[model samples]
Target: MTTITLVQGDITRQSADAIVNAANSSLLGGGGVDGAIHRRGGPAILEDCRRLRASHYGKGLPTGRAVATTAGNLDARWVIHTVGPRFTREEDRSELLASCYRESLRVADELGARTVAFPAVSAGIYGWPMDDAARIAVETVRATETSVEEVRFVLFDEPAYEAFARQVG
Candidate 1:
């Protein structure tokens, strides 16, 4: 059984075997957690992302899918980039949102990452409600089977942290 933990801090600073980035499809980098990881993780991270863009992800990564790259300057061996779905009331894309966590864990298992730090996928600029995002993330991680010994949700703010805490509790 994996132990779920919550931390109200920057995901970039977490020292885990893998850090999950809530990246956009572009994967080049954007605002929020994606930009933070790219900036702190340094050029090597971007270099790997560029290589991935040139080869496997020419048109950008699809939503709900995930891939890994060098952690660069961050305190981790690998960075798992997962694109989250944009929330909308017209359609239910919760499955895709849940996939972000599931796929990231899948990649972490592949990298032999026993400890992983994750951000709230789509809860930031992507407009997914903080509560729903927290619920989905916690529930998915609880349900998924992986080799990870610890899964830490590194939230960036009090609200995000509280939301995840509610679900975690």
Candidate 2:
């Protein structure tokens, strides 16, 4: 069984085997966690992303899908980039949101990552409610079967941490 952990800190600083980035489809970089990872992980990350763009992801990564790249300067061996769905009341897109966690874990398992640090996918700029995002993330990780030994949700704020804590509890 995988142990679920929560930390109220920057995901970029967490030293895990893999760090999950809540990236936009562009994969080049954007605000929030994506930009932070790109900035801290240095040019090598962008270089890998560029290569991915040139080859497999020419139209940008699709929502609910995930891809891996070098961790670069961060304290991890690989960075798994997962695009999250934008929340909207008109439609129930919770499955796509849950896929972010599931797919990241899939990529982690593929990379032989025992420990992975993840941010709150889509809860930031993408506008997914914190409680719902937390619930989906925790529930999905709990349900998924992977080789990862530890899955850490590295939240960026107290509210986000508390939200995940509630679900984790």
**lDDT of model 1, residue 90:** 98
* Per-residue C-alpha lDDT of model 2 across residues 1-169, encoded as one tens digit per residue: 9999999999999999999999999899999999999999999999999999999999999999999999999999999999999999999999999899999999999889999999999999999999999999999999999999999999999999999999999
Candidate 2 lDDT for residue 120: 93
Clashing pairs in 2: none
The TM-scores, one per candidate, come to: 0.99, 0.99
CA shift of 95, model 1, Å: 0.3
Model 1, residue 92: what's the lDDT? 99
Give the C-alpha miss distance for residue 8 in model 1, angstroms: 0.4
Q: Point out where model 2 deviates above 4 Å.
A: none
28-114 per-residue lDDT for model 1 (tens digits): 999999999999999999999999999999999999999999999999999999999999999999999999999999999999999
